[model samples]
Target: MRISAVPDAADVDLEKIDLFDPLLYSDGDPHPIWTAMRQRAPLHRQVLPDGRQFWSVTRHGDACRVLSAHREFSSERGSLLHQLGKGDAASGKMLVSADPPRHSELRGPLNRMFSAKAVASAEPRIRRAVLATLPPPGHSGPWDVATSAALLPMAVAASFMAFPEEDWVDLVQWTSMAAAPEDPSFRVSSPAATLAIAHHQLFDYFAKHMRHRRANPGEDVVSYLTTMRAGSEQLTDEEVVYNCYSLLLGANATTPHTVAGTILAMAEHAPHFLRHGDADGTRVPLLIEEGLRWTSPASSFLRHAVQDVTLSGGTVREGDAVVVWVGSANRDEEVFSEPFRFDLTRDAGRHIAFGFGPHYCLGSALARIALRIYFSEFLRRFAGAELAGDPVHLRSNFIAGLVHLPMSLVPRAGT
Candidate 1:
């Protein structure tokens, strides 16, 4: 990989650039900013307008170190930039916000449930769910990529978790509110209102299901976790609800963005992104990896340093918040050759899009299965696809993605 020359520390003013600003993500591109930071200030400290501070890690090596060394850089404080200053209410209880050995205890059963074998067993149901989102054979017109794609992940998650299928569409709305409330399309009155309504609805819905599932338990995620145990400890009602919220939030938030981004890349990026997908069905996995890499839907994760640690960039003091930009790390020119070019022929060797180490995405297998089936069906049904209208990006520093993608798919002859 060739190292591109960027402005030195003397030339680029870092303070003026607010990485936390959702507008910067919605209306502008942050990749150039990340590239500049990667070269000049890989471990630069950023102060919010109110004087609160956190360190931003942009380089790939430093991100890996920070994410893998989970103990030294703990998540128990908070795991997202939005949760800065104020600690997470779900800390220690939620899998994404918990630190080990408790993180392991909470995650072990989920790991088994989300393993490859489990996804394979559920693949047929997942495929059925995915197929419902696309046009039927011999039919192709204008497709609402955003509206249709968002349904696929929720349907898969709800089916697996045994949540009512009737509520899948609303669950998508709740996730949008939770993940990108600032966005005009998703917001309700105010961000606080957005959060309050989403949380209340989600928790209330899950609580009802939890109580019912306890009596009429079956082979589903809620029931499985309700009975899951590590050693003598079992998951509490709160833990079950919070974790289910985490699961649904993740599915609704990340997977659809990935699907849209991959489609956008394929239809709009001209030559570079479409090469691998047009090959054979066997290449769908590789395409999914590239899509995950290119979009990096979950932009950054925040970890509080429990102990003083040294990164490739510099030293992180104890009690300091460490924001690892996984999106930036995925696009680091040092790790990837021509990082901007969306090429699927290249191997998915170094992307930390799903994150790294102990906190690597629990839904990764399920996500891949969803995408694989989605793309497989898409390729078979559509002769080609193209962007049809202006794409709308979600306004968020946390969940980075487009909220709406208008597209048209060309139906294959005889399909």
Candidate 2:
């Protein structure tokens, strides 16, 4: 609840800071804490309230090293901060949680689908989806940018998977619950209960869809996945269903927050918005990258040390959980000059916002295209926009996102 300015690095008590606490991120300003960690304790260790302890990798290089060394740092156990016990449904089935060989097998078939060229091919569809989600021209004032930004990504996901348009809302709801189970709006009986229910719902939905895709194949992601093979192995029904769930969650969850954050950034920093408006097509890509870096929506993912590893003068024993803070890494002063400033022209492509290494986000390409189209259309339609009220950040350490952003849009005069 306190909004005090971040103290000097020396003043910070590394032991006292709880990076896993959801409230640390509730204000949408975890940068200062991360900055202190990166500078003073790049390999800080802390224990969660539940008595689980993990090493937090805050620096860019260290984070990259941990993420890249999949052999030494495994994701097979789980990728979330909260450890899902052996009984947990999504422990190793999802693509993000699989280790190499298996990781390669899961991701190999979908590589081309998310390639730069493939995402470029989806631009027109993404643009149409963006346009469809935008409010009618001449309608403006105190709109919830978060809700508006949230809609198109789900629509795009449905289009990509050949899922029903009517089910987009359901997809959004389930993914939201799964992603931010601690948030009051999305939480059901409890975080675990909410996640279990959401997982069940998503699995059921995908299972039914997978059955249909097998019976009558189409050119969607589901159809391709159903037929995809890995050497002598083929995807199981559970694999297909769980991976579909993974894709849906990955594709739907992060971009909307980035889009909403972009709008907020532009409104707060008018010069940036003006520059974006005046720039050519090449500049748009930079803007999109900047948005991803600035927002860092998919904040942190956990990796388990498969073997003893020395990082930043700290030893992480085998089986120790290592939390790689992508959001922190993106703003590390070592890699990014003036990291706090939102400089669209900066080489933000180097940012690990989509993460690094084997478990890197599969839908990164699609997310970029969706964000580009959304911003392009948004700027063209609205001459200027401003925040109408305080933004509400999602209460989850895993996702740095705005769940609500009230904004007033000023349409282009002629429109």
Candidate 3:
């Protein structure tokens, strides 16, 4: 059942094999080509316009190998397809791009912040935030669910990390620009410009807070990060600043999309709505997992092979960039049963929605907490909720998620 591999040269000549555009990858339709790759050329070679040759790893098992075998495929080269432009210091420090030892060292101390206990403990506050934003009992019309859904994760994350509440809106803006660097229309020209503005704004904001946190370290993750001493290898100011910056963007962008995507999934499969009665409590968690697997916010991750390693009988030479198609892997039939069917009870734990191996999402627990809280409250409030209009997904392929979810909420009778 393998589809033939379209050679890197043939399709690429006419702007066919574009790995750079986030829209192409983020459209959530890589399976057709990916299936072809897995069955025929599991290790297909791709050539960028600039003549950069990369190995496209499409299957579930091979993707896992690339992500896990850090020794073989290094994250140091880059984590996405974006060019590593000169003076891009922040990209290197972010956990997504760093290799082991350094990555492990940076991520180790802050694990507790994203742990289940810590996230669970923030439920009361998260619930309040979600409740505040829910549509009133009888409301039913198009409204932006993405903006409303964002409050839960951002509020919880800011509170946990000691980020200022008044700055939440700006923080969200900064993080969005940083995460979706490929989106030209998000702001002025160049993803670099957007990132530079965001970096300075966030760094200045954090520097002010860092002074206070250093003087009187609290129970928050930022406080812990500021004071941590990892055997004479504590985090530097830049690391601390960028780590918070990265965490804020990562935590904010993904979870809300999960909530929005889950709602869309529910609306699309209205038949499933019958199973949960008017109570969404029963159906929300399952919806979250499927939404994550379906939408796959992180989409594709970029890795560089350290040495010449033969993958799927193709030769990936040293210094070659490898694009790991995660969304494709999520839909691979070999790993997931009936990959297209949105089965609520399916065990999708193995999906690479969050990525694989050492660089797996650090804030997974927190992301889940935010998603669960929003859905739990959403279900409780609006069981009969459905999309009032077609949703708009972000233009960029990187960090794919709904930019606008126009939906109406209605109260259920039983509840």
Candidate 4:
């Protein structure tokens, strides 16, 4: 359903108040605004100059309830505020956009591919990919972590999709543009145009492989999709294509930024934790949880209400869009004491950075695995690091991250 304008909010200042504004993320820290809203207006309203309106959920409990209550809040409508007016075209076809029984049927075959055991078994290759792509252990000049470290996730994802190894670098570039189309680094004619072009290129690329896999089937996810059945029904060729797009997007969106953001946090507050290999593995878990909580890269996701529902004392009418700020929820004062402080020891177990319910990130395990290996190797090489320049943030409301992280690595003593 197309979202209609809220005539009641005609006087609101969209430029200053719109939660979907990219400038809120790119220009400076937006935490204060979120903090204010979380406390004073946990269930807030955001109206765009164009008249599109959405409810902004900022508190942890409210965020969780809204994200998980799929019956009341529909994912098939749209999953991002960028589609506030026009709902998702790939709805009901892609797993991320499907709800209930359909979502379950579609997800069952794919779950094992990223199960914990699967990721554990893939660790050897993941470690090798990390080792191969990482800069020299002792190099101590300014390093662009975003550009250099993106290969590990891309490599891991490409292997699963059966994308060629030689195309890994190109895949990385395409995925990044597709992920953060508004960033000047990726913008072609405009943000919308950039996103469209990137998707066009990606869809055409996946179509070639999908068609090839029809006759020459392989063990990869795309190959499986080309032939796999859901009970008596086969996935339409478009469904296979949409799933491929979703998987490629999942691989590119989270971890690299999480790495860059964690590195930023390390440079800023937790440098003392570096250089130790975490030989026991226990310390790394705390660091990983806290880093994911602090960074919160999958910043916001959209859900349109399917029914009139009351949440956190506010009534959300049917058809109203709700944007849950996972980034803000991670920092909710009630959930994390002094949520702003980067405390590696704090138990960040309640973090809904992965969202909640059926729509939770399928690649959460892979993202964690990527971070675990990357940090272990990073610390063994560098004693500590600090920012050489400000981190360039991605101009996206859905994904929060560093576009470029300029940092000087401190090599292990003597090397």
* Local error of candidate 1 at residue 218 (angstroms): 0.9
Model 3 residue runs over 4 Å out of place are 1-15, 25-29, 84-93, 274-282
Model 4 segments more than 4 A misplaced: 1-16, 275-277
lDDT of 2: 0.80
How high a TM-score does candidate 3 get? 0.88
Model 2, which residues run further than 4 Å from truth? Answer: 1-10, 84-92
lDDT of 3 by residue, 68-130 (tens): 888888887667666422213655576766887777777776676677787788878766666
lDDT of each: 0.83, 0.80, 0.70, 0.81
Off by over 4 Å in 1: 1-12, 270-279
Candidate 1 global lDDT = 0.83
The TM-score of predicted model 2 comes to 0.94
Across residues 18-120, which tens digit of lDDT does each residue of candidate 2 receive? 7877878885356767878887788888875666788889888998999999889988778878662332355566688787787787788789887889878
The better candidate by lDDT, 1 or 2, is 1
Tell me the RMSD of model 2 versus the true structure.
2.3
Q: What's each prediction's clash count?
A: 0, 0, 2, 0
Lowest summed lDDT across 10 adjacent residues in model 3 is found at 1-10
TM-score of each: 0.94, 0.94, 0.88, 0.94
How well does candidate 4 match the true structure, expressed as C-alpha RMSD? Answer: 5.1
Q: Please report the candidate that would top lDDT against the real structure.
A: 1
